[model samples]
Target: MTCSIFFSTELPNDRPQVSGALPRAPQRWTMEWCVKTPDGRTHINNSRTIQRATVAEVNAIMATTINGIKAEIGDLATFISGRLTSHGGTRKNRKGGKRR
Candidate 1:
């Protein structure tokens, strides 16, 4: 399994500012994660937009997300391995033939 994390900033579009009013804040930042298989095919892709966040906050969020992904992958691997072992690492065809 492979994974990637990306961080980016988003700027607001050019527009006339109103007089005597606080300026609009930029969209701020976006964080994205992509999980891929060993074959280089994408398995999961997700993103979140953050506003007015500090670097520390971003890092915390990223770490948590990564840990969650790791746990999920581990659980899936365990389940698959258990199933394979239960079947003696062999599969049966419709014609009662054993398949590896």
Candidate 2:
């Protein structure tokens, strides 16, 4: 049983979608902090220095994300319903590359 066999989910092959959150608060460093070396590799710290989060706490935080998105538009239900086929994730910092 290899990784490719164990954790493979398929999506429809199509053009990628682009999206942006209009009125969103800046994402900042919370309990989950990571360090990215200059070489472009990302490291998630899992040490005593970090406080552990409970499942409930994490879910609560994630719920706020939807609230933030709704607040960004005049009518979230309408906006989302209209762009059901489009709206993707945040596009900021999309220049995913090693800046040497």
Candidate 3:
């Protein structure tokens, strides 16, 4: 099984809305996936998530889940690197110029 994905969110209703158009802490995540083997295997998948958050919850996913996925797809170096940066990464853009 091979999977690739991206996830992030920034909401104006910063306080944390439990429901409705005005959400309190609405979040979002999207994933694209496929499973395959030349011999006898193939699969496909996708998903999204919008919900609340605690600092710890996000951190745990960053620390644990991200690393776990990298290890799982350890053979795919270039693909994993770009996928992690583009999707699973958490780098805030800086004001002045370059990398943050």
Candidate 4:
């Protein structure tokens, strides 16, 4: 099975007003997932809305995600390099001479 994930921000269209009352907390971010099966069917799922998230909270989440992606890239580079080294440290021409 293969899955795709998405993240989005939502804002209220309008806020209700009342006499001498504070407004409701804002609804901020949401995480959604779309899953697909070989049978050509898709399923969508959503996480509960995140309300009133602070700047630091959002920053931390971004930093963590970036770090995770960087780690994955490094691992992939290592794997590819290892594969190349195992096959032969360098490529050769069809005439069996090193291509420089």
lDDT of 1 by residue, 23-85 (tens): 133223345555554555555444554455443465576667756876877633211100000
Instruction: Residues 1-100, candidate 2: write the lDDT tens digits.
Output: 0000000012235222324332232222132223334455544422111333433343355345434444643222321211111112345565766455
Question: lDDT per model, in order?
Answer: 0.39, 0.29, 0.36, 0.32
Model 2, which residues run further than 4 Å from truth? 1-51, 77-100
Clashing pairs in 4: none
Q: Note each model's CA RMSD in angstroms.
A: 22.5, 19.2, 15.7, 24.6
Which of the predicted structures, 1 or 4, would earn the higher lDDT when compared with the native? 1
**Candidate 4 RMSD computed on C-alpha atoms after optimal superposition onto the true structure:** 24.6
Candidate with more favorable, higher TM-score: 1 or 2: 1
Task: Residues 7-99, candidate 3: write the lDDT tens digits.
Answer: 322334322222223222423434343434334444344443344433335434444544565477553423221111112333368577665
Q: How does candidate 2 fare on TM-score?
A: 0.26
**Any runs in candidate 4 off by more than 4 Å, and if so which?**
1-27, 30-51, 75-100
Cα deviation in Å at residue 20, candidate 3? 20
lDDT of 3 at 66: 41
* lDDT by residue for model 4 (1-100), tens: 1112222222134221122222232224333334344455544444433444433453355445434544744533211100000011233446766565
- Give the lDDT of residue 60 in candidate 2: 50
- The lDDT leader among the candidates is 1
For model 1, what is the alpha-carbon lDDT of residue 27? 26
